[model samples]
Target: MGNTDIFLDKYKQLENCAINEFKLPPDGSAVAKLEKRSEFKDIKYELNYCREVRNLLQHNQKLDDEFPVEPSNKMIELLDTVIDRIKNPVRCIDVAILDRNLIWRSYEDRVLPTIKLMNEKNISHIPILKDRRVVGDFSDNCVFPFLLGDDNCHIDENTRFKDLKQYLDLEAHPSEVFKFIPADSKLSYAEKLYEEARNRHERIGLVFLTANGRSDERILGILTAWLIIGQ
Candidate 1:
């Protein structure tokens, strides 16, 4: 996971370079200089993965949504191959999650304004808090039916919508709300959770909550499958 961060940083930097600067010949001296500065070898797996996807797409090959390759293996092999020649240690690569400045809302508040925020952020999910504790989540699945009147028309500016609080109850669906925990958690456990979600074909969002179940547990940072694969 450590190399994943370095890989992503290098990938993004190279992406910016490619977009903003003119391309040099793949084997030219200037290309060597560019490679030296950015250290593309640290992110070879990601590049190869992208190349594979591009090849598949360009050739009209059908690629499944599923990921068949193993992430931990690819990262390890890449690091081992370049260990002596590289300046950095591959084992030092770390996983840092993206932050979602969560907006806490009471179930009593009108749904329109809350749903509006969800739409504006382009996030499929939002956490609902009651008395400082997470009570439930407000997501596309939860909001859509109500908006379309297929479930119930409980969304007006003046309507007090606590009646639908059952949808957000924590006990209702514990797995739907991902609790961020320590990275030290066994890779097998993490992989199991990810695999179960993938097999079931659900959108996976797991938060790597910082250590200790303290005040920080209220919110940490978000993790997605693509982010884990160092994409």
Candidate 2:
């Protein structure tokens, strides 16, 4: 027989079996005319639990004569949905070059107009340069050395900002503290640089001080983790 014929025959058999258990109309037209409002509403939870029980029985799990199945909205949400927002975060990452003309100083000497420039431009960390060479990466807190009694805590106009020449060239303390991350580095590597700064327990801020690693260590940019995320 055709698929439709076979389906109709099975449907008739099911209707006969159900009619044997309940008082069903004998006339096909009377049965088709029967109208009843559905009593069940919002039974998806129960249906899902019953499906799970059926699966457990098929899998040969413990099948008791009578068992209770509890459904949790929390587990349903977890298993049914892809939580991408929690697993992955969107972070804007970029780099900016440090202005070579910029100067810096402690809290003492006339407040160093560069500090005001940095504030006006929304620049948080400013690197003190002398003769196109980096002297110190100065944030708002670099003024502490001058607040104590240090008279020479100032970026003189004639001083040259030391460039990152070699790996060993960055061995100086507050004076010659030269450290930087490349602009071509990945975001994870940039994060690691900031993490290392945190682990050092020093004021050595995470400065993505950019330089041309190919030609020479030219001051191309200066950045931080905050700048990376902000980008």
Error of 1 at 91 (Å): 12
Tens-digit lDDT track of model 2 for 1-231: 533233334334433533443367664421122112011112335434434443443344334742233334443342222122112322212345444433444223333455567788887665544444454455544444433435554544432223111211224335323356555545445555555666776444435344433213445555555665553
Which segments of model 2 are wrong by more than 4 Å?
1-94, 98-111, 150-178, 200-206, 211-216
> TM-score per candidate, in order?
0.45, 0.39
Report lDDT (CA) for all predictions: 0.49, 0.41
* Residue 224 CA displacement from its true place in model 2, Å: 1.3
User: Cα lDDT of model 2 overall?
Assistant: 0.41
